[model samples]
Target: MGKGHTSANGGSRTEGYQYDINEKSILGDEWCSMYSTTAPIKFEKSHFETAMMHLIREPNINSTAILRADILREAVFEIEPNGKPKVKEEKTQDLEVTDPEAKKIGIDDLDVRVAPTNPLLNLHVVIQIVRRIIPRNLYKDAIMNQTCLIMNSSSSKPSTSLVVYTPHIKAEDECPFYIPHVKAVGILFHNNVLSVHYIPFDNVELLRDESQRAVRTAWRLLQTAYKHSMGIMEGYEKRVNHDQVVDKVDFQDCYIAFKKRYSKFLVDNWAESTDPKKHVFEDIAIAAFLFELWKKIYGKDFKEKIQFKDLGCGNGALCYILISEGIRGKGIDARRRKSWSIYPPDVQAALKEQVIVPSLLLRPHPEVRKRIPHLEHNGGLFPVKVAHELIAPATIVYSSEDLLQSPQVNVTEFSPDTFIIGNHSDELTCWIPLLGYPFIVIPCCSHNFSGERVRFNVRKSTLQSSSKSLGNSTYAGLVDHVEYIANRVGWKVEKEMLRIPSTRNAAIIGYENPFLDQFPTQEVYDVIIEDGGPDNWIQNTMALMKRNPRSH
Candidate 1:
């Protein structure tokens, strides 16, 4: 009989030739399809029946009836070498059999003697039986089947193993696959990759430390530059006044000037008052500071040669200082001559010899002429006596009996290089710069372009703004207004804390460099026109000239 005709149980074949079932071939073709069908079939009987039917139905069946019958029996259960029922202990192990094509296959030995046998074990035995009966190629195709399973595995659980037949395993390039380790949190890339690093949020403190270091370095450079500029000024002063003593510098001059200007208060209160030295010390300190500041900004070349015109120059103390320093200077006021008469003997002699008395007071009223008998014969009276008494020039200039009521002064004749200095120029602060000279006005009243009285309006605006009040007095507002006007006209201005009597401690310093382009001359002219004619001390003198043409 042929190999397909006998049922092989271990080393023994059946005595009667029986047909062997092609169980492997049937299972390879129909296993997946039969499993998917909805029809119910008895697990025990249908396993053998299905295998037999598949073999019989094959058009190319070569096996005889006896061989097919034997194959069908083997499809249901494996047998032992003897015809006796197999013992459970002997049949538990799998049986290894060589097929006709010399390919090795495993079959599970069936144990019919075992009580209450497991169906899953029986099923495993039947599957092995099918493998032994099928062709090698068919068995290879059947073994290549793939399956996927999902389970609720924890992070610590091992991954399920994938069984792949060696010949059926796919290449890495065929379809890429990745296995990821579980993490608390991670970054995923498009390529199924993850990164492991991160940055913290508290790095701003590092940036702040770097910025502070840079600022400190910049401040040090600025201070160094300032000190270097001051040193240059000191060197220049030494060179310029080599013959003069150190006490004769503008700083010392400012001190003497302040004392001379406010001598009345000094003499009357200097000895009797407490803190007599305080005023002198304050003046020296302020002057020293001003000298240093000026030197740092504009070198020492200009201060010694700078020409100054003191408008409303009361007693000409500041002008005297500038002149004594060899600065080309001139002073004007309705009271300059009057102030000279009240000067101590030495100051009065120095003033009479050195300064020119250009314009004199015109006493339009008989009462004023009676007070100074020289006015009727000479078209003007000296200002030394008036400033000595601290008398207001407005009382004389605006007197009703004056030939020209509201008499005005013209300052143009006083030289183009002049910088008009209105030190405590009361009403003249509003009028001095309008005389076509560059000006530094320390104002003393609130008189405006129009003769309207300006009251303290501090609540309306800031003291920095022109409309606001500077202080409780008219003098304070006038100083504020002058500062506002100078800024409006594009003058580079500096406000200094002046060392002078009266708490109105502001001083303005203005310089005009001929090298600089001329200011809007037409605008300045319009301002002069708008201010209703120049009424400065010189302009008022000119008005006196025009009134009595032959007086000079």
Candidate 2:
């Protein structure tokens, strides 16, 4: 049972088991149940208590905190002559932060009177069910109603004990009787030992599973909190904290601006099955981060001097946002997304549909070059099964001398300060670093030079050294490999766990190297050529290509 959210059974025991009603009912109206569990044995009392406090303050610790769970608002507790606790008007910050003495309070240990701005708003059950079943319109209406009541609810008259208010289904509400209107969960810390207990009203047979889940979740949260306090939770921390690598550039302002200006349009026009909030939020964050990065590198006058090429830019929303921000950039992908049309004509012009092939591959095929005089500037290896007209319907190969004059062959040539952006660039993830320029690769699908989905064995040094090996998941391994490759190629690499909406958020960054003169283009070329090069890579890319009929 939770305080201000207790079971109907009137359970008020702290140390031993207590059952006020023993009769069992199908809906569980008569049985009273209390559950207790111990905390991790390794954690010292002080450390565990502090961790627990932190968990309450930051329930988003493991993304497990119930979205509606009551945040401690204001409360007062006083023990009456009889054992009942009396509540008085009290105001303060979250108890998790203000009340260190609260650690001594256990289940049914102290009666508290609370004035929460969010009484029912903190109910975990309400949050879970409403999110699943209620329509957005109804949910908004209910929230507005709750907000009005919360604002009007006076703190002048506090309840007796912390177990004051419980959620009961009213005529309009659909709460089950088995569920206690008000319940309280308590944690006790004494002499380096910890105990957790739940006080439910009459323990209904139906609530056994729910009660057990609550206990298990609490136990897990305790362990997580303990691990977080000790700084040993390498895996757990990564998921909770989004911005891992801090740079001089701050993109928060850019993100704020995007949300203020463009969020409604993006949300209304979202076409994918994935959550629109996350997709749009991620792009905004990317734009903000990139803009700041550009500002930091180019000083105040860094507009046209910096140009970007987004390899495998899906949907082209990011490119649109960047271009709209005054940074000149173009996105190239084997296929164009439908969202491309939604953009204005100017932004549409910045997006191109083309497959990228390393220039080195063209140099080796003399037979293909003889037929195409413009081999140096324009040469394409098409999929064996897919017709060229389907993929590159309007693509025209140009001469190397006219490289600067061609749109399709722009990838083959790079001017100084060209920035390669690889957001989920699948096959292009690994190649971005080898392109010998400043680039940011947010790897999604792992691929080798042959353009096949191949997972690289993450280096022991990189994996073991990383504080964020959340798991040996394939995605994490791929991100590690990309970071490792960037470092291996002598590109002063920097890795950041972006504050993006997606779980696959690691960004491998390469900037201008001070040792560029020592490790020039030839050195980069020698390394790749010696490592079997892109000799067979082009053939594989062409073989896998599937022409998009829609492009035609």
Candidate 3:
């Protein structure tokens, strides 16, 4: 939410709220459209009215609470022309002050007799009361009426339809501006049906197109805007869960405490000047999640005992947090980040710079043969020389014995119970499951055999194909691919949408290592070999390894 420059309730200018409604980029217009999409909820007309009453009164706690708490960052109520209400912003800010003349009304005082006609109009005055992300003069068309009708006219449809609306403000205007008001409607009709309607203002489109094209030098502006809109639309839909948890982990208390401490430390230290809020909070969330997961798996005192290796640990922030919590872990990445140097000496020592090549890919050398005589190996060609600077480690066919030996055939080797953490691990997304250890992967980039971003054809289930589907994006397909690989390797998988600061928050957790016992280990390898021919697993694994000039 942007801060408002003036006070509407005759309070001090600094006391006013900010309206942060910046949807111009999403809608491709110089002026933000008063656009809203509808959702059909299950309820009778009377029931809907009751819900609406509750929603308007305590909207911060309603179904759309997250949007309010996150995106809007505040709850806004319509003020009758003559009536006043005390204002409250969801997040506490330095500029917040009370409007003494405004009398606050409780849910009991709210009149739900009329159906709210336009959400844009309903929240317009209050939105202007604080900050405006859009220009006030730009959408003079959206504010024809000052107040939104509490009750719909006598003939309006009943409880199932839900509409969400907000107005646009101008960049130049510090105060309220009104003119030709236009409204965009979203109708969620019968049987969970939905329709979004936007009024196309001719001049507005021309202004946006011409102005944006002039300023945007890159070709991705339009593509980025399209993706942004798609993401927002997807957010409006109800989330579906594909993996069910066999064992539950509760880390809410740990997360809350850690978040507070971590956030304060970040602000005080301030390593990266450019926007650390989102990244800082997200790393903290991951910390809390990992802590809880470890507690569940190894009992409450499981800290140093459960070792971890964070593959593709960008910035090594998570490694620092985990180590501070008394967990012994090392983070491996191809490239070291600047933020790594900012950590204390002890914390810095835990982060390692090396690309992790799965031991299954490398060929056995004399060192392995001498040290571990019982280690079994199958024949595979070593990496071919390319530009001579880089080396693509060959795929070393392994029996269960090699896994136990912890062979240093490549960059690093894993211990028996070492848990793998692939937090936004791009190329390593699919390899985590094949390593045959308990792991949790939160995939970010979509990549394939050649370490390239490629989309895989999704094999949707019968139910998913027939149902009202939220079509999969490249990211979602990648998540599915990771889950599929986990299943192929005989791992019991569970997925969770982590409570984090970023949009890419889904995690595929391979907690149950089905191949942990001797019989199943060989059985799982046999299935992998049979699935493709004996060499098929190697080919598939190699294709995903990042190729370089050193290994043509």
Candidate 4:
């Protein structure tokens, strides 16, 4: 080990011989002792090879590579046979090398252009890679480079045991104290025997518990992933399952920028019983997604073209982020949260405390609150006084004309350009799509139009399409139901399983409502009055408002 970094596996890496590697560039522990997997060792080498490569491309799949930000996952690129990268050039950073001659290595440059990083294999298919890793919180955007070598024998049955290797180039001074410089991971596949071989860095005395555990977990992830790839385990896929709706890079950049500006403010000062990190970070991610989504739908001038109204805005963190980012928006909640006071005056102003009453209940035909219907014969009447509308069959229960005329009932209509955000808006979830304005609603706790908590079911057909058997969970059912309502109301709905760190991250978006011209929403009216209408659902919502936090 001459002046560079070397592993305990005896694969000494001298700064002078760093580029001198070739077919002799080994992967596993030359000392033949370190770490290895125990169970699930029996697997075909071919299947294991595919899995090994997949894991190399995405180390974060097993959720053990958490010390860096997308380094081992998104940033790594394959070095093609022609010495060019397979990844887009714009996404890569300048490669690190002390030798200035690396870029201009010619035929006379002593075979320095390839080898170790691209080990030679005469008959097998060889894969060469240059990987990078950046510490998550130690220093922002600081990148460190590594390399991987995969040489697969075409006929696994005829070959001896093959040890695939991906070695890390350790940087002692640059490495975070919380993470190790390297964990030389090796894999052996021969005659139904598969085991991971891990070699800790040579300086075991300098290693910390955190870094050691990180390395241990890394090898475990390899074993688990290999088994899953061989169909020996179940669902060993990527951990953070973000949907491919918006550009991931754009979303991640937005999140990082937003977090840098607001995470401390929200987390340090949070007053809710819930863990601030979860709520704060999740909201930040959602805000990031919204920024990207709006930009996609309305171009770069989305903030100038659209104004948002976030219903059930809870702690108002999302509103704070959007407003701070120069997007004009207001967040309304049934009750004001303690965290709202920490925001600036302008941000605070964007949060309102008000219960929602859809225009359906406010547009009056009669004074139904009195319960004595002066014009009812046998059916389809406003019925008796109840908070949650218990209609006989088909009933639209949220609004009225007499109440608008009355000072007690406050009904506010949105402008044609208004964009509604029903984020965890409970009762407002179902109605957000029905309103003429476009909306993005994330259903949290399931609630009917009457503000009553109800566990809706996923239609038998929809359960199959959902990632989960949504029928088993109330939250998923509500998400599906909200989309259903939007579709019924002549709105072309879209859904994004948001990248936010919350399970209830499914966002149903309806940016284009074809029924905008149909102001009365006669179609919504028909849905409300289905099967016979609520027995007393007509006036139930308004009457029940007296009990909940959303009282008008």
Winner by lDDT: 4
How many residue pairs clash in each candidate at the backbone level? 28, 27, 32, 30
Candidate 1's C-alpha runs over 4 A off are 1-298, 336-410, 436-438, 450-453, 456-476, 512-520, 525-552
| Cα TM-score per model | 0.34, 0.58, 0.51, 0.72
**Model 2 agreement with the true structure over 462-547: per-residue lDDT tens digits:** 55565254356688778877776677777777777787777777788888676544333555565566545654565444443354
Which scores higher on lDDT, 1 or 2?
2
Range of the 10 consecutive residues with the lowest summed lDDT in candidate 3: 11-20
- Per-residue lDDT tens digits for candidate 3, residues 1-552, read 112242343211111111112233222232332212233333343443333333333222322211111122333454445655344433322221122222211212212122233443222223211111211122131111111222222223332333333333222221222212223222222233222223333434422231232112111221222223344444434354421332221344455456655667765665654467777778887898888877777888887567999987877778888888788888876666777887878878877755455654443433565688865553444332223337664445444344334332233456776898999988678777777678999988876534555785455762264122324766667777777778877788777777676667778897786465532244444444443423333333333334421100
Off by over 4 Å in 3: 1-43, 46-237, 240-252, 267-274, 363-381, 384-412, 449-452, 462-470, 519-552
Per-residue accuracy of model 1 over 1-552 as CA lDDT, tens digit each: 112222243111222211112222111221110001112212222222233233322211321111111121122233456523332422122333323332221223222211111122121222211112322132232211111111111211221111000111233222101101111111111111111111112332221221233222222222322233334434422211110112223443344344444544433433222343554344333334444444544467657534656655554444444454445665555433433454345444433222111221232233445688765423442221122247554423333223223323331335555566666555456655445456656555555543334543332354444323234355555555565556555566656545344455566655543422444334554554564533344333333322311100
Candidate 4 local lDDT, residue 225: 47
Off by over 4 Å in 4: 1-33, 38-42, 62-125, 131-142, 158-170, 176-180, 198-201, 204-215, 230-241, 364-399, 405-412, 467-471, 531-552
* Model 3: lDDT to the true structure: 0.48
Question: Any runs in candidate 2 off by more than 4 Å, and if so which?
Answer: 1-9, 12-42, 49-59, 62-188, 191-242, 247-253, 271-278, 296-305, 360-407, 467-473, 515-520, 540-552
Global Cα lDDT for candidate 4: 0.58
Looking at candidate 4, the ten consecutive residues that score lowest on lDDT are 104-113
Greater-TM-score candidate between 1 and 4: 4
